[model samples]
Target: MSTAVTAGASGAPRRVPATVHRRRWAILGVLIFALLVVVLDNSILNVAMKTIASPAPIGLGASQSDLEWAINSYTLVFAGLLFTSGLLGDRLGRKKVLLAGMVVFGGGSLLSAVAGSPGQLITFRAVMGLGGALVMPATLAIIMNVFERDEQPKAIGVWAGAVGLAIAIGPITGGLLLQHFWWGSVFLVNLPIVLVALVGMVLLIPDSRDPNPGRLDPVGVLLSVIGLVLLIYGIIKGGQLADFTDPAAWGTVAGGLAVLAAFVLYERRAEHPALDVTWFRNPRFSASVAVIGLVFFALMGVTFFGAFYLQSVRGYSALKAGALLLPLAVAQMAFAPRARLVVDRYGVRATCAGGMALVALAFLGYLTLDTTTPIWVLEVIGFVMGTGMAHVMPPVTVTIMSALPREKAGSGSAINNTFRQVGGSLGVAVLGAMLSAAYRNGMSDHLSAVPPALRGPAGESIEATLGVARQLGPRGAALVDPAKESFVHAMHIVAGTSAGVILLGAVVALVLFPGRLPVPDAVGAQPEAEPEAAPAETA
Candidate 1:
C-alpha cells in the first residue's frame, strides 16, 4: 500500500490511493516510532550524567562541561543540518532520506555504546544528530502530505505527544538500563528501536518530494554548522572556567557571532537562500518560533540541573530518579493529544499565554526544592510543566506547518525544529555556565579545608566534589554537606533564570500571537488571523 505521489513537476495532482489513505494512521505510527529513538537517546543520557562522570570502571569520568558538550554536540549538529536535511528530503525523496537516516542513527548509537571516553561519546552523538536532522523534518512533512487539513491537527497532536512522552520516559529507561546493565546501555538501547523503525519505514512508508525545490545552499549549511559549533564551544568553555573574563571565552563568542552575522548576510543576498529569512516577517511564524526557542531554553537549562539535583544531592539511584520524572511524562501523555481542543475554543494567544504561565509557575517550584524537599512536590512541578508544554507545542507547530505550502512541508518543519534545538543547546550552555559560576563561588570558602591541589577539580561540580570526597576518606566526608548546599544554591540561580526566560516567552506569546474566532471552520481555526493555515493542495 505504498503511496502514489504526483510527478516532481506535474501539472495534475494525483489522488491518494484508497489503500494508502487507509494506512495513513499506520504510517503515522511508524513515523512516531522513528521520532522516539532520536528523543530517547538524549533523554536517557540525562539520567546517566552522574554515572558518566564517575571514574574509569564505573563511568567515563567526564566533567560538567564535558557532559554539557556531550549534550550540545548532538543538538548543534541537529540544528545546523536541519534546514539542509529538510531541503534534501524535499528534493531527493523523503522515504529514501528517512531510511538512510535510520541506518546512520543506528550506527551512531552502536559507536556511542562502545565509547571509551567523553570525547568519543560527544563525536558519536553528533553523528546521531545528523541522522536526526534528516528524520525529524521528513516525519512532519510526510504527515502533511498524507493527511487532510482537518486530520492534520489530530495527527500532529499525536506526533507532538509522542515527542514529549519520549523525552519524559527516556530518563526512566536510562535508569533501568544503568541499574542492571551499564551506562553505555543507554546508547545501546536505541539500536533495537532503530531496527524496528527501519523495518517499519521499509514496509509502510512511501517516497515523495517537492515538485519545485530550492537550491541546496551548501555554503549556508557550512556557515551555520561552524558558527553554532563555535558559539556552543565558547559557552561551554566559559562555564568550565566559571568566568568570561578570559580572552578565550569572550573572543570565541565574538567570532561565532560574527560568523553567524556573515551567514545571515550571505543568506539575504543569495539567489536561493537555504533559509528563507523572510519567513520571520510573518508575525505569527516568528512569534511561534520565538516562543518555542524560549520555552526550550528554559526547559533544557532546568533539566540539565535537574539530573544533578535528583541523583547527586538527593542520593537517589538512577532508577529512582527516573521514576520521579513520571508525573511530567503522565501530564504530557494525558494532555498533549487534547490540547488542540483548547486552541479551537480559546484561540492561540490566550491558550499559549495560559500554558506559558503554568510553565513559569512550575519553574518557581524548583526554587523551593532542597536536599530533602518532598519528592511529590517535584512531581507536581513536572506535571505542571508538562501540561503547559503540551498545550504550547501543538498550536505553534500547527501554525508553522500550515503557513507553508504542502510541497514545502520539509522546510516548514525544519524551521520549527531548528529554533527548538538551537534554544535547547544555548540553554544548556548558558545555564550550565551560570550553574558552574555560582557553585564555584559558593564552594570556594568551603573548599579551603580540602587539599589545595584538588580544589580546582572539586569545585567543578557536585559529582566531582563527591568523587573527590570519597577519595579523601574521612577528611572528604566533611565536604558532603557543603557540596550539597552549594549545588542547591547553584540550582536555585538556574531555576530563577529559567523562570524569567519562560515569562519572556509568555509575553511574546501574548503580544505577538494573533487572536482568533471562538470556533475554527472546516478550513482552519483562524483564516483571518496572521499566518493562516490554509488548506494546501493534496498530492
Candidate 2:
C-alpha cells in the first residue's frame, strides 16, 4: 500500500504518490477509535458511579458530589488546558503530542481502575484530564491539517457523530460491564483500546506542526488553569450559600472571581498567550462561543440531573436509564449531518437561533413533568432537545475554527471547549443544588416523625437514609417513599429553571448570530488580520 508517513517527531518522510497515501485512512480509523475510548470514558463513568462506589477495594461510597467530580474534574482540566494544548501541538508535533497524551490517559485509567479510595480516584481523574487536554485538540488539529476545508464540516460532523455514538452507547456499555464485573472494569476497558491506538499511531499517523510556532506562555497556562478551577469551585459552592453571608462558601466565590479576572489581564499581556483574547472583539466569534457554551451547559445539566432522577427517584435501574437516554443520542446523531446543510443554506444566525428556540420549547415541555410523567413524553422532549443541540454545536465549531488562522486552530478548539466546560460545570452545580434544596425543603413535612433535629439533616441526605431503609425491608422502605416524592417535586422546580435559562439563551442567539454563515474566501481559511506579533510580556 502507498503511504505518506513521518518517521519521527521532527523529520519529514520521503514523498509518496497520492495513490499510495490513500490507504493511510487506517490511521484515521485508529484515531477515531481512540477518540471513542476517551469520549466513552466520560459518560460511562457517570452511569457506573454508584456501582463503582459500592463495596469494593475502592471503599468509596459514591455520593452525588463524588459522581459530579468523577465527570467534572476530567472535563474541568481538559477544558482549562484546551487553548494551551493546541499551541503545544503546534510547537511539539501532532504525533508526538498524541502519543504522550495516550500514555498519560492510559496510565490514568490504570490508576483509576485500582484506586482504593474516592480521593485516589479524584487524583487519578485529574491525571486523565491532563492527558485528555492533549489528545482531543491534537486529534482535531491533525484532521484539519489532513483534509481540505471543503471536507472539514463533513469530516468533523462524522467525528462528532462518533462522539455522539460514544455518548449513546457508554451507559449501555457501562451497564453491561458493571453487570459482568466490578466498577473498576469500566476503567480497565481502556487499556486494550489505547494499546491498539498507540500501535496504530506509529504505523499510520504522521508527525506535523505549525511552520511558525511562537514561544510558550507558562504564566498564561497557570492562570487559565487556576482561573477555571476557582470559577467552577465558586459556582458549585453557590448552591450551598445560606444568604450569601457564609464566608466559607462565599470566600470560594470571591477568590475564584479574582483568579479569573487576573487570568484575563495576564492573557492580554502575555507573549504567546494561551488564549487569544482578540477573538472576542469579533461579534461572531463571541456570540458563537457563548451559544456553544449555553447549549452544552443545558445539555450537561439534563444529563447529570436526569441520570440521578431516573435511578434515585423514577425507580429505573442503571440499565434502563441508559436505555432511556438512547433516543436523545439518536436524535443528536441523526440531526448533526443535516445541521451543516442547514448552516450552509440558512446561515449560522438563523440555524443557531432557531435551534435555541426549539431547545427552549423543549424546556417549556419539561415544565409539565411530574413523578408520573410517561416515558414517551420524556422521549419526545429528548428528541427535540437533542436535535436542537446537535444543530448548534457543529455549526458554531465550524464558524469559530474557520474564522481563525491555521496556527490558531488548536487554541481555538481549546477555548471553545473551555467555555463549554465552564457552562456545563455551572449547569450541574446550579441545577443540582436547586434540586437538592427544593427536595430538602419539600421533604421537611414528610420527615416530621424522624425527630425535629434529624429531620433537617435527613432531608439533605435522603439517599443515605434510603439505603438504610432498603436494608430494613418493606415498612422502612415505605416510610422513605414520601421523601422520595418530595425530592421528585424538587426536581420539577430544577427543570423549570433550566427551561428558563435555555429560553434566554435562545433569545440571545437569535439576536446575536448573523442571518447566515459567513462566506469566507475559502473554507477553513484564516481571516485577514495585521501581521503576526509576538505575545506581549506579562508582569
Candidate 3:
C-alpha cells in the first residue's frame, strides 16, 4: 500500500510502488524469455552458414570474409551500442525500450529470411544487433530492480543459466531447421518466440526508469560507437589477412583504442555521465568483469573453430554436429543452478578460480584432438568446458550486479554485457587469425607441388581445400590428407593458446575477488562522506 524509497542514479531517493515487488518472479520469466531470444540469435547462424552460402536456389555466393562478417557485424554493433541503450532505458522506461527492441529484432529477422544477397543479410543482422543491444541490458537491469538484494544471486543465476541454455540450444535448433527447411529458417524462428515474449512482457512487467534522469550525452554515444566499430573491424580484418603487420590493420586498432580512451576521459568529466567509470575501482567488479571476458574469449573462440572442425574436417552433417554439442549444453544447464550454492559456501573467488581451472583442463584435452579423434572424446571435453563456463558465469555475474547501486543497474548491466560481447568478438578474431595463419602455412608447404592456380584456393580455407580435393578425384588424396593434418595442427595451436589465457584469468580471479559476497547492507552502500540525498519529488 505504501511506496518504498530507493536511491536513484544521481544518489537522490525515488519512490517505488509496493505493487512492483509483487510481480518480480513472473517478470523474471518474461525477462528470461527475452534474453533467450537475443542470446540465441548470436549463435544460431553458426550452423546455418554453410547452407546459406551453398550455390543455386538459395545461393548467397558468400566468400569466407562475408561469412565472418555475417557473424561479427551483429556482435560489433551489439557491443558498441549497449551502454547508450542502457542509458536510454533508464531515461525512457525500460519496458517501453524492451518492447520496441522486440519489434525491431523481429523485423530484422523477417528481413533476413528473404535477403537475396550476402550484403543484405549482413545489413539485416546489424539491425538485429541494434535491437539486441536494447534488449540485453534491460533484462538484467529489470531483474536488479525487481529482486531484492538477498534474492538477487539466485535470480541472476537463473538469468545467467538462460544464456547458457540458449548457447546450447541455438545450434541444435538451427541444425534441425536447416534439415527441414532453408537456411532462412534459422532467422525466421525468432518470430514466434519474440511474439510470446512481447505479450508476456506487456502483461507481467512493470515500467521503471531513473527518477532523476539527466541530460543525454550524444558525444559519448558517438565516440563509443565509432570506436567499437573500428576496433572490431580491425580485428576481423587481421584475422582474415593473418597479418597484423599491415598498416591498415594496426592503424585501425590503434586509432580505435585512442578514441575509446578519449571516450573514457570525456565520461569522467561529463556532468551527466552515461557510465560510472568509478565502478571499476572496486576490485570485485573489475575481477568479475575480467573473469567473464576471459571465459567468453576462450569459449567463443573454441566454438567458432570447433564447429568447423566437426563439420568440415570430420565430415559430419550440420545436424549431427549440432547433436554432438548436446553434452556441452547439458553440462552447463546442470551445473549453473548449483554454482550459486557453491559460491555461497566456498566464496566467489574460489568458485571462479576452480571454474577457470576446469576450463583450462578442457582446453588441454582439446589439444589432443585430430582427424582420428573419436566423437566421444570431444563430447567428454565439451562437457568439461561447459561445466567450467557454467560455474564462472553465474557467480561472476552476481558479483558484478551485486557490487553496483540499484540506480546504476542499467549502466552496470550494459558494461558487463559489453565486456562479454567484446571478449567473444576478440576471441573469434584473435584465435581465428592464429588458426588461419597456421593452416595457410601448413597447406602451402604441402601443396607446393600442385599448380600455383589450384594451390591458392586450397590454401585459403578448408572448404576450398576440400573442393579442390573433390575435383582432383584419385589424385585428391595427396591434397586432402595434408590439408586435414594442417587443420588439426592449427586447431591444436589455438587450443593451447586459449588454455594459457584462461589460466591467467584464474590467477586474476584468485588475486582480486574477495573471499565472500559482501554483506547485504554493505552491498552498493553509499559512501559515508556523502550523506543520503533527499528523495526526488513525485510529479
Candidate 4:
C-alpha cells in the first residue's frame, strides 16, 4: 500500500500516513539510542579526567588547558559543522548520513581509546564531533519526519528525556569503568552501543530527505566554520593566558565576529541560503534559542568545575563523585514529564522564565559551599538545578521546532543545537578561564611563604599543588589546607557569576518570548517569500 499525506482545508489538521503512524515509536527508539551515545560521550570524560591526567601507565600529565581542550574540542567542531552537516543530510539521504556518522564516530572512539597523548585524544574527539554533527540533527529531523503534529510534543518529550538520561548516566558509567578498568574504557565502551544502534537504525528506519534540496553554500560554510573556531579559540586562549588584553585573544575574537557578520549578510542575499537568516525574526524562536544557550552555558560551566571540586578539593573518589551526581539525574527525570504539562498549562514564557529563576536560586545556594559543607547540601543543590533545567529544555526545544516548516526541521534542529553547543563551549572556556585566573592569584598569595622552587608548579593547578604538598612530607601539610581554601574561593566566584548570567537569561526570556506561541500554520505549509529588506534580529 502506498502511504500518503492528506492535505487539509485552511486551519485544519493534516492526516499522517498510516505507514508512518505505525512505525513511529520504533523509529523513535533508534533515534534515541543514537542520541544517547552522542550526548553520553560529551560528559563521560569528566569523571575520568583524573585517571587520564595522572602520572603513570596512562599518564598524559595534562594541564588544565589540555583537559579543557579534551572536552571542548568535540563541542567546537560539532558546533562549527552542524549547519553544513544538516544541509548534506537534507540533500543526500538522512539515514545514509546517519549510518555513515555512526561508523565515523565508532572509528574515532577506537582511536581515542588507544590515544597516548592529550593532543591525540583531543584530535580524535574532534573526529567524533564531526560524526556527531551528522547524528544530532538527523535524530530530530527523523522524528519530525516520522511523527504527526499531535504526536510531536510527546515524541519530542521522549527525545528530550533521553538527553537528560544520558547526562545522568554518563558520569556513573565513567566512574564504574574507571573503578574497575582503565580510563580508555570510557571511549571503548561506545563501541558496543554504537554497534547496536547501527544495526537497529539500518533495519528499522527508512531514508528521508528534502524533496527540493537546494544548492550547497560553500562560502557560507567556510565563513561559519572559520568564524566559530577562531571565536572559541580566542576564548580558550584568553583563559589559559589569563589576559583579556592579549592581541591574539581579543583580536581573533573581533575577527571571528566580523566574519560571522559577513556570513549573515551574505546568507540574506544568497538564493539558496545555507541557513535561513530570517528565522531570528520570530521572537519565540530567537528567545527559545537564547534561553537554551544560557541554560547550557550555566550547566556546562558548573559541571566542569563541580567535578573537580568534588574530587580534588573534597577528596571524593571518582566513583563517589559520580554516584553523588545521581540525585541530579533523579530530579531531572522526576521533573521532565511535569515540565511538558506546565508548558501546556502555563505557556513557554512563564515555564521557561520560572525554570531559569530556579536554576539561578540553585546557583546562589552553591555560593555557600566550602570544604566543610555537608555532602547532603551539595545533593540538594544539584537536585534543585536539575529540576529547573528539566523545566527549561523541553518547551524551549519544542518552541524552536514548532516555528519552522516540517521540511526545514533538519536545518532548524541544527541551528538550535549549534547555539547550544556554542554556549556549552563558551561556558567551559569562559568559566574555566575565570576559575584558573582566580585560583592562580589566590594560590600565589597563599603559597608566597613556600620555597620559591615549589611556588611555580603549585600555582599551575589544584592537582599540581596537592601533588607538590604530597612530595614535601610534613612541610607539605601546610600547603594542603591553603590550596583547598583557594580552590573553594574560586568556586564561589564562579557560582555567583553563573547565577547572575542565568538571571539575565531569565529576564530576556520573560521580556522577549510572547505570553504564548503564535498558532502555527499547517505542517509542511510553504514558508512565505523572504522580504528583501528584513532587518536581522540579534540572537
Candidate 5:
C-alpha cells in the first residue's frame, strides 16, 4: 500500500506518500462535493426567491431591493475576496484553508436557515460568500498539487462536471425542498454536503503550499478586493437599471477599473506580489482567460434569459423548467471528461474553436425557439450548448494552469475564476439591457391595453405584464398574447446577438491558443509504480 508521490506544486518535486497519488481522484471528488453547494447556490436560489420574499411564518417579507441585495451581497463579497483567499492558500496551506472555509460556510448556512429577518439573511449570506471565496480557489489549487500535468485536464473535467450536476439539479432540489419544508430548507441542504466534504478533506487531502512564498502584499490584496466588490456591485446595478449610463452604475464601475489599474501598478513594484501581472503578457495565457470570460458571458446571459423564457413565456413551473435543463447538465457530465481526448487528437486550438462553433450552433437553435416549441427540442439545444462548454472550459483551464508554475496554481485558478465571474457579470448586464430594450420596443403599441398607471411596469417584463393582467380580470386577457409574443421576439434577437459573440470567441481560440498540446515526453517511459506518470483513461 506504500507508494511515492511527486507533489506538483513545489519548485522542486516534493516526494510524498503514494496514497496521495492513489486517492487523488477521491480527493477531487470531495472537493467537488464541497464546491457543489457553493456553485449551485446562486441558481438554486432562483426557485426559492418568491418563497423568501413572502411574509413571515413563510418567509421574511423581503422587498425587491432587499432581495437584490441579498443576492448581490453574496456575489460581491465572494468575488472581492477570491484573489486574497487564493493568496492565503498559497502562503498558508491549501488543505487548511479549504477546511476552514468549509466550516465557515457551513456555519453561515445554518445561520442563514434560521434568520428572523431579511437583513440577517443578507448578512449571513455575505458570510457564506466569504467562506465560498476561500473554498473555490483552494479546490483547484489542491488539484494542481495532487495531479500530474498530463492528468490535470482529466481531473479538471470531473471537477467541471460537478458544476453541471449542480446546474442540472439545483432548481429541482430547491423546488422540492421548498415544497416539503420551510424556505430555510433550501439553505439547510448545504449541511450534508459540507459535512461530507469536511470529512473527506480531513481523511484524504494533504496540505500543500508555496515553499518560497515572499513577503505578503497586503496592498495588492486590499486593492483587488476593493476593486472587484465595486465592479461586481456596479455590474449588478447596471443590470437592474438596464442602463450603464446612470451615474450610480458607471461611476462605481469606473472607480473599480481605476483601482484595479492601481493594483496592477503596485504589484509590478512589490517585491512580493500577490499575483504575477506579467502572465497577461503571454498570448496563450491571456487568450485562455479571455475565452473563459467570453464563453461565460454568452452562457450566463443566455441562461438568465432562458429561465424567463421557460417560466414566463412558456408557462412552465420552476420545477419543470429546471428538469428541462437536466439534459444540458447530463451532456456536460458525459462529455467534459472526454474533452481532453479531443484536445489530444486535434490540438487545443481546433478543439476549443470547434467547441465554440458548436456553442454558436446552439445559439442559432435558440434563435429558432418559439413559445410553442416542443420541450424535447429545448432539451436538445441545451444539450448542444452544454457539450460545447464541456469542451471549452477544460482545455482553456489546462492552458492557463500550464502557463503558470505549479506553485502559483492558486493565483492561476483565481485568475481563471475572476475572469469567468466578471465575464458573466458583463454578459448579464449588457445582454439584459439589450433584452429589455428590445422587449420594450416590441411592446410599444401592445401596451395600450394596459392601464395608464401600469403601462410602464407592464412593458418591463412578461412577469410584470402578467401581474398587471391578473388584476384587470377579463379585460386583462388582451395583454397575455402580446406579452408572450414580445418576449419571444426579444429572446430571438438576443439569441442572434449571443451567437455572434460565441463565433467571435471561436476566432479568438483559433488565432491565440497554442497550436497543439505537445505529447508529454514521459508518455512512453512511465513507471507503473509511480501513480502520476500515466494518462488516466478515466478519472
Candidate 6:
C-alpha cells in the first residue's frame, strides 16, 4: 500500500498509489504522538528543577547558574544540530532516522532518570537534546512527505495542536509527579511514551526518501553547527557571564554570524549543500521560520519565568502554579486546531502576523504585572497570549512544510525548529540572568537596613532575596516577611523585560513576513530532501 511519486505534467512531484492518501490521516497521528513526546520533555522538567537542585537528589550543590544550564544544555545541542539532523533524515530515510531518534531519546531519558549528580543529569540531557534534534524535524518532514498539498494545512494544524497540548499539560503533569515522587520521575515519564512511539513507528510508519538526493556538504554542516552554538551561547551569556559590551560576548556573536554567513556562501557554491540558502530568497520560507522563532522565544520566556514568578515570588506552591496555568493551555487547545481553517480562508500572512501582534499585546499586559497584581489580570494575559500562539503556529508550520520539495522537508523542519530551540534557550538564560542581577542588587540594598547581628544564615535556599528573609527568622524576618517590597520590584523588572522581548518579536514578524504568501507553484517544486520539525513555535 506504499506510494510512488513522480513529477507531474507541470514538473512538480505528486504522490502515486492513491491509496496512500487514505492512510495519511493515520500516519499523521503517529507523527503527532512522536511530536508530543518531544514537546512535553522540553518543559516538563521545570516543575522539578528546584528538587533537582537539592543536595539529597543530586548532591551537586547546584546554583542559579547551574539551574539555567540544566535547562539550556539540552536546548543548546538541540538547536545547534537540528538543521544537520534534518538533512541527514532527508538524505537517508525518514522512518529509519525517526525511529533511531526515538530510541536515542528514550535512552537519554533513562540515563537522566538515574543520574546521581547535576553534571550527570546535564550530560544526559544533552544526549536527549541530540535525540530531540532528530525527532522534531523528522515528525514534520514525515507529515509533509505523507500528506497531499491540500490536506497538509489541516494535518499541520493537528500537529500544532498536539504540540500545544504537550506544552500546556507538561507543567501540571510535572508538578503532580514532583509533588508525589522524586525529581527523577520527570525524566522517567518520557520512557513509556517513547516505547509506545517506538513500537507504533516501527509497525505503522513508512519509509520515504528524496528522489534526487544531493551529496552531503560536510563544510556546510560544520559551519552551521558551530555558528549556531556560538550565537546561542553569546545570547544566553550576554547579560550574565558578561554584558553585551564585553568583547568576548560581542565577539562570539559577531563570529557566529560570520560563520553563518560563510556557511551560506559555501552552500550556494557546493554541488550538494546541506541547506539550500536559496530558501531564504523566498520570503515565504524565511518569514515562516523567523516568526516561529520569535513566538517560541516569547512563549518559552513567559512559561519558564511565569512559573518561577508564581511559585517563588508569589509564594504559591508548585502544584498551585501548575493549576493556575491550566487555563492558558486550555486556550491554546481550543484555538490551535481551528487555525488551519482560519489560515486556509485568510492566508498565512494574516494568521501569523495577527498572532504575533496578539502576543505583543499580551506582553504589554505582562509589562504591568506585579506581586500584588490581580490573578484575573494574569489569566487574561495568558489567555490572549495562548490565542495568539494558536493563530500563528499552524499556518507557519503548513507554509514552511508545504513550500519545500518532498526531499528537503527534513532540513526545512530542522532549521525552523533549531531556531526555536535556540530562541527558547536564549530566552531563559537571558531573562534568568536579568532576574538574578535585579534580585541581588535589590537584596543587597534592602538588607542594608537590617541589623548586622541578624544577617546570619537561617538555613534556607540562597538563590535570591528570599534567601535573606529565610535566614533572618521571625524577629529578623520582619523586614521582609510581610512584604519584600524590593524583591517584588525585581520580579516585576524581570516580567517587564520579558514583555519587551515579546513585543520585539512582533516587530520582527511584521517586518520579515510578506503581506501574503505566494501561490504554491511560483516557488520551484523540484522533489528535494526534507528536514525535521524542530521549529520553536511548533513545540
lDDT of 3 at 25: 85
lDDT per residue as tens, model 6, 65-177: 77777777887788888888888787788788899889999999999888877788889999998888889988988888777565667777778778778876787888888
Model 1, 1-539: lDDT tens per residue? 22343321223333444445567899999999899999888888878887899999889999776887787788767877887788888778788888989899999999998999999999999999899988999899888877656567778889988987887688788878887988889989888898988898888876777766566788987887688667766765665566777778778888888988998999999998877788778888888989989999989899889988988999887778877887887887888889879988898889889998999999999999989888889999999998998888888888787766677778888888878877886787789889988998898988888888999889988888999999999999989999999999999999999999999998998888878522233343322111112233345
In the range 1-539, model 4's lDDT, one tens digit per residue, is: 23344444345354445455567899899898899999898778887887888865865778677887887788778887887888777778678888988999999999999998899999999999999988999898788777665557678877877787898789889988887888899999999999999999987786777777688888988888888887877766676666768998899888889989999999999998888889999888888888878878887888878988898999988778878888778877778756778877898889889999999999988888999899999999989888888888877887888788766877878888888887886787788888888888888777766689888888977888999899888988888888888889898899998999899999988898777655546643433211112222233
TM-score of each: 0.88, 0.87, 0.92, 0.92, 0.94, 0.87
Off by over 4 Å in 4: 1-12, 60-66, 521-539
Cα-based lDDT at residue 307, candidate 5: 93
Clash count per candidate = 0, 8, 0, 0, 1, 20
Evaluated with lDDT, which candidate comes out highest?
5
Query: Tens digits of per-residue lDDT for model 5 on 1-539?
Result: 22353434423333334557778888888999888989878778888988999899988999877888888888888888888888888878888889999999999999999999999999999999999989999999888888776688999998888889898899999878887999998888999999988998998888887877888888888999898988998899998899999999999999999999999999898888887889899899999999999998888889889999999988888899899999899999999999999988899999999999989999999877887888888999999989998999889998888777677878888888888989988898889899999999988998776679989988888878888889898998898888889988998888898899999999999998987754333332111211123332322
Candidate 2 lDDT, tens digit per residue, 348-437?
778877787777778777666766788788899888887887777777787777767766666676777777777887777677776777
lDDT of each: 0.82, 0.72, 0.82, 0.81, 0.85, 0.73
Q: Evaluate residue 209 in candidate 6 and report its C-alpha lDDT on the 0 to 100 scale.
A: 69
Candidate 2's clash total is 8
lDDT of 2 at 207: 65
Better-scoring candidate (TM-score), 2 or 4:
4
Residue 517, model 5, lDDT:
57
A best-first ranking of the candidates according to their lDDT comes to 5, 3, 1, 4, 6, 2
User: Pairing residues by index, what is the TM-score of model 5?
Assistant: 0.94
Candidate 3 residue 256 Cα shift, in angstroms, is 1.1
Deviation (Å) of 167 in candidate 1: 1.9
